[model samples]
Target: MKQSDQAVVFGKRKEPHTIIIARGSEIRHFTVRPWMAAFAGSAFAALAIGYLLATSYLVLRDDLIGAATARQARMQQAYEDRISALRSQVDRITSRQLLDQQLMETKVSELIERQSQLTKRHGRLGPLLDRAEAVVNGAKPAEGSAPAKPETRVELPSPAADTQLAYAAVGSAKNPFALWSTRNSAAQADSSADHADKLFVTLNQSLRTIESEQLARIDSLAENAYQTADVISDALESAGLPVDADFGKADVGGPLIAVDNPSMFDTKVKELDEALDKLDKVKKEAQRLPLANPAPGRSISSTFGVRRDPLLGTPALHSGMDFRAPMGSDARATAAGIVVKAGWNGGYGRMVEVDHGSGFSTRYAHLSRIDVREGQKIATGDTIGEVGTSGRSTGPHLHYEVRRNGEAVDPLRFLKLGKKVGQYL
Candidate 1:
């Protein structure tokens, strides 16, 4: 053994390895350094480890692929579930918005209906209000004039409501009465609903107020007209005459509104119309009757009822009032009527007998000349003859006689009644 072999044997030094080969008496020897031997060993070990690793990968490939695919599927399913939840939330929000929009439209429709109802009520009361105004102004319709058309300066409850209603109905670009509408957000829709509720309450209150006022006005007018009519009718009844036997119908015409079920307003309006009609008829009849003096401001030489006959100088029936007048004084008809007698008679010269309607008649006697012929229409305050002492009269005097149903009554009573109620007529 050499000293280097002894050091390697004692593990104190590195050494190279040797290889020797002999074939058919031929010998060869080669030496490998320590670094080359170590490298060869390390290469062998690396190749073996690589082979083992390759075998392991081939055996477990399917399982790894399955696990990876499952993990990916779980992640995909989780994402899909999240997307579905979000979609459902969106759908819910959209549905809520749609419902709110529908509700808003319905509210607008209700508002329109209420407005139409109020308009109808106002229109129905318009004519009655006009009539009341006429009475207030102390104006009367002509005897044969057409009924006046209804006119008013009154306005509706709210113009803003009308504009909003129009916008809702047709989605009008421009608001006719006031500001236009704008729907921007959910918050705005909610606020608009609340505002509509408040507006509804306010409109209802306004309608109630208008209804009450209209009814009150109608009642007042009806009461006044009826009172006047009643007074005139009482006066006619006190004086023997037909109240409305042949003169109740007036030549008045207008649009007559008919209703299926009448409200209080309608009832009051009808009452007011009836009262005005009654008043008109009463006035016409009163004017037609002999309620005026034949000669105004004249001293009555004799009165109706029993009186001494001036020509006979004996007790005789004198059935007329005598008004003292100078010769050639005007003798007028006391009421409107058709002349029945306009020629001289035996007791009365140049007499004019007028047949007023409703079984009433009047006579103008002691006239020299007759201006009205028989069958001629004469009005009150129209000249019928000239006063003179032509027949059975002591001097120039007028004889005015008022007869009801051919029976003479007191003319002084009618004259006094006329003085009391002429202004009303």
Candidate 2:
């Protein structure tokens, strides 16, 4: 091959090149080899490519940043929405819980009120029962009658039962949010709500039980009062005394005024209270009635009715029954009354007349000594005089008379009635 051709095809040596620039009167020249020129071209190409890449990057920077920022904003919005949903759920749960709590509180208040009324009723009945027990068990003997025998008393429940019932009925509901601190979710809220509902149901059932027990107790008391009142009324009728008009069924009034709004249990309690009040009134009236024998441990010497008078020795109407008693034996008042007459009378000496209420009065005649004065208050079994023979009396004895509106009735009737009443006094 030719040398030139060979050099061109496979050059092993560098070739020189020159560049010349002329401007006005100045000239510059640069010489370079073929290899150096090629290197310079390669460097220029690399710089051009780098510049293009730098410019393209600068132009697209804002779009890239904008796209990234939009993506981040969308993600943040989605997170905020999720948080708002959770907050809404919490709010709903809280509102429902508040409503439930309010309802429970209202129910608790009602139960407490019922318990208070029941307790008050029990308090009133307790004393009345005690009084009845005393009356039935500690009865004093009637004058000129055998002593009363001791009786067994029915046992009553302890007062602590009432206190326990009050505590249970007034108990507060458990906290509905008790488990809120441990977990916060719809499931947790639902669980808490269910627990509250169950608690309220249990509390309501307890209140109902308490109310039932109270009603039963009240009914028992009312029954006892009714029975006692019936007995007292019969005794009063036998003694020829008028029973109180208020005790009649027609005179029964409405329920008592309540401290709060009335309920069925309250109405029942009020009725029981009214019955007890009537029974107590009857008891007091019975105490005031003349139903006791005037002379104790004595036998009737002269019976009331038509009989031979000891002084006259002829058929005469006996105004009173004469009790055979030792001289100077105590003569007690037959009833609680105010003494209206004392000292001597036409046919009797050292007599005492007691005016019981309700147009009833009693007289003790032929007494050796008068212990009671006029206008003096005396109770049953109070010493009013001393038995002796005086005036028209033939022996040491007491003449006792029961008068209704100043008219003498058979004294034996009252003495018999006294004997019957003394058994329950």
Candidate 3:
């Protein structure tokens, strides 16, 4: 056994003692240096420092990890709030779209109403215009049987209310007017498409009708011209004048009529021929005659003469012609003129004064209704007023007066002149 130089403490020791131990074959020595105490204390302090450093590093890492987790949670919360805001915005946008759809539906309803009225107007006008054209052209074939008069009463459709169509589909409004309008709009669209197709078809038909009418007119004129030319040529041949020759190259004076013509027939014929040529020129120029009924259809109620008044036993000088017609009958113009006055007069009621060109003027009196206004240009045969028994009139009649250069003139001469014109003006 080896003995160590270690001090052993005894509970009953009175003095400090050093104990030594010896070994039989070997000795073991242990020395403690004074600097070793500092070394040992330093080592113990270093170990404690190392342990503290490790613990601090672990704690700091844990704190940093916890802070990072907390920061991530905050960012996630902010993103969730932003997502919620976006979702709210989307909800608002969807609500706006629904509102807009309702507005569009309202607008569509209004448009449908307007479209219906237009269609009705077009229908009435289209037929009226067609009839007017037919009458004017005299192109309709005569009917075999008497025609039945159509009912003149016309009914028009009204509009729709907003409350009636709030819940219905765009076209399913319960209102009769709305339903009719929607149907009419669809029908009109179909009709418009059909009209476009039919317009081409109708255009072709109208073109054919116009061409036929024009061709008929041309043919009639040609036939009349041929007959006239033939008659002229035959008459010239019989008279020993140039036959089958153009009028531009003809001579009538040398030997055909001779210097001794007792009847003066050749001279009259020449004059008549010249008059016919003038008439042809007038016809080509679309000249209008004085009136359709040149000698007005009314009865000759009064003449230009002195007459005794019915009310008073006094003589009065009548300066114009008076025509008696049914009250409210159309009173056509005597000639193309500008209406100078359309107002009441002292003795003549509802007088219409017209200023015809070439220093000529006319006056119409005792009218029930004045059709033409002052300063209006009226064509010959156009209705200027309606006949009636007005102030100073014996009965339903028209008092017409003719004036030339502002002087009262006899109307009989003008009536005779008007009679010479053709029927159509």
Local accuracy by lDDT, each model: 0.73, 0.73, 0.55
> Model 1 misses residue 372 by how many Å?
2.1
For model 1, which pairs clash? none
* lDDT of each residue in 1-425, candidate 3, tens digit only: 12232334323435433334569876655555657767989999999999999999897998889999999999999999999986775555444434444554554444454435334544643454343233223221122322222212322223243223322333332232332234534344334334334433443354345334433333333333333333333333443333224544556543233355533333433443443453344332222223234236667877877887756869988877788688888888877889999989878888898887656788888888898899999887788989987778778888888777788776765565344323212
Task: Kindly indicate the candidate among 1 and 3 with the higher lDDT.
Answer: 1
Question: 203-310, model 1: which lDDT tens digit per residue?
Answer: 557656665665666666666676666666766777655577555445786533446543656666787888788777787778888987788778899988776778
What residue pairs clash in candidate 2, if any at all? 15-34, 135-425, 144-295, 144-296, 144-297
Candidate 2 weakest lDDT stretch, 10 residues: 148-157
Cα lDDT over the full model 1:
0.73
Backbone atom clashes (below 3 Å) for every candidate:
0, 5, 0
Clash count (model 1, backbone only): 0
